[model samples]
Target: MKYDWILFDADETLFHFDAFKGIQLMFSRKGVDFTQADYNQYQEVNKPLWVAYQNGKIDAHELKHSRFLQWAEKLGTTTMELNSAFLNAMADICTLLPGARDLIDSLSERAKLGIITNGFEELQDVRLEKTGLKKFFEQVIISEQVGVAKPDKKIFDYALGKMNYPCKSRVLMVGDTLQSDIVGGINFGIETCWLNRHNAEKEEGLEPTYIVSSLVELKKILIP
Candidate 1:
């Protein structure tokens, strides 16, 4: 391996983050049929909250509770309860991406692994335990605990501290999002690989150290 440590992003990078499916599961338990239209309606509120969270304009608690406020009011439950239910639903449905296990297993033999995510603490722990991937990681940094999200250098600083301050040149961050993972790693003075599975357009004024369309492709790059 070219790096001493390989840090990952949790959702949509290593694991499948099927928010629509999770929301459907959550609402079915409450006797509501969550349709595509309902999901679209939900994302109208949820998507901006995530952007705000990433930009450091909002905290995790606000993002969590605010997204489900309308549904919580309609269902006569607290936003916190709805958020917990949503996280739990996501956990129960969690599955590693197609090549995630093989990639992680291969990398673990050569480099230490860690996760630095903006995902909630509740889902991260449960899903890692359920997937039996917890033992492979030396550090799992959640923004909910760190008081900052990625794209802010503070979270990367916190992760580097937990990683015992490894030489920056020997660290690589891998994630699916360009704004958070690639930009954050670059700004923090480490290499980064962008997992551009959907062939999304590259953002202006940003370039990743490497780019791969799939984990299988990424595996070939690192393990070749």
Candidate 2:
């Protein structure tokens, strides 16, 4: 077999997270009474929290709660209300990217499929369940659930451990982020496939074994 297990990233790779950004902005404006400045501030604060979460310096609940608290303080609002609004907004708008379902369906018959995401377990579960994409994956490993995130190598090892497959060479890591997916896969000694949806220029020191503009292209590389 060309590949045994196909591991995937959730957000931006399979899910259209950019589509939810506008919804988040709308929620901040209406539900949280947030200004443009406050919205920008929240993103600034949230990014680092995710990095810390990935680094294992903090846990999922702490990261989410702390991000909300930080944003609430910046906006002079209650953290409880902001957190509620955030969760509601996320739940309302979370959706899969174009061709995500079709691609998964096509690949499942040919290769064992799984999700390896650096996201909160509950939230990722909710998104996958709501989007109807959860059924395709034989296994789902979230960083929060495993206590390790991408780019650290340990998380990839954990996923492989769960897979219990003898052929390490017959595994591929597919995701949108170069920093996380490519780096982590390289560390794990698996092939990496980059879902370059944005056509962004590659940065220095990060590389993938394969690059495709769409999930539809996956069948060409994997099945052919």
Candidate 3:
């Protein structure tokens, strides 16, 4: 392998972060039927918050609590409680993306592994542990813990510190998001692999060092 370290973004990149599925599980616990339309409504509030979150306009706590505020009011619960329940529900329903196991297993042997995500700390650890993926990552850095989100470079600096300041070129960031993960790594002067699974149109001025449609393709590059 050419790299000594490989850092991944957790949600959508390595794990299946089906927020709709998580919401369904959450509402079922309260005996409410969370329908597809309900989920669509939730995303109306949730998706923009995430965009704001990754762009550093909003904090993680605000994103979590604000998105569930309407539901919390309906369920007669605190936003904190609702957010916790949502994280728990998400953890319950979480699973690794296909080839995540094989990619991590193969890379962990040849390179040190880490996770630097804008995801909440509450769900990240639980989901990783629940999915049996925690052991493979030597460091798991959450933006909430660092008080800064991805694409900001401060979070990347924090992660680099945790990684003992490895040579920038020898570390590779693998993530699904173009704005946060790819650009952040690019700004930090490290190689990045954009996991463009859905074949999204590439944006201008944000080219990653490499692009792949799947982790299987990534495995070939790193392990070949």
Best by TM-score: 1
What lDDT tens digits, residue by residue, belong to model 2 across residues 193-215? 99998898987777788999998
Indicate whether candidate 1 or candidate 3 has the larger lDDT.
1
Candidates 1 and 2 compared: the better one by TM-score is: 1
Q: What's the TM-score of every candidate structure?
A: 0.98, 0.87, 0.97
**Per-model lDDT:** 0.95, 0.79, 0.91
Question: Could you tell me which residue pairs clash in candidate 3?
Answer: none
Candidate 1 residue-wise lDDT, 90-133, digit = tens = 99899999899999989999999999999999899899899989
Q: State the displacement of the C-alpha of residue 184, model 2, in Å, after optimal TM-score superposition.
A: 0.5
Q: Which ten residues in a row have the lowest lDDT in candidate 3?
A: 125-134
Model 3 spans > 4 angstroms off = none
Local error of candidate 3 at residue 4 (angstroms):
0.8
Error of 2 at 210 (Å): 0.3
What is every candidate's alpha-carbon RMSD to the true fold?
0.7, 2.6, 1.0
Model 2, C-alpha of 139: deviation from truth (Å): 0.9
Q: Tell me how far candidate 3 lies from the true structure as C-alpha RMSD in angstroms.
A: 1.0
Show the lowest summed lDDT stretch of 10 residues, model 1. 203-212
Expressed as tens digits, the lDDT of each residue in 1-48 for candidate 3 is 899999999988999988888888998999999999998898899999
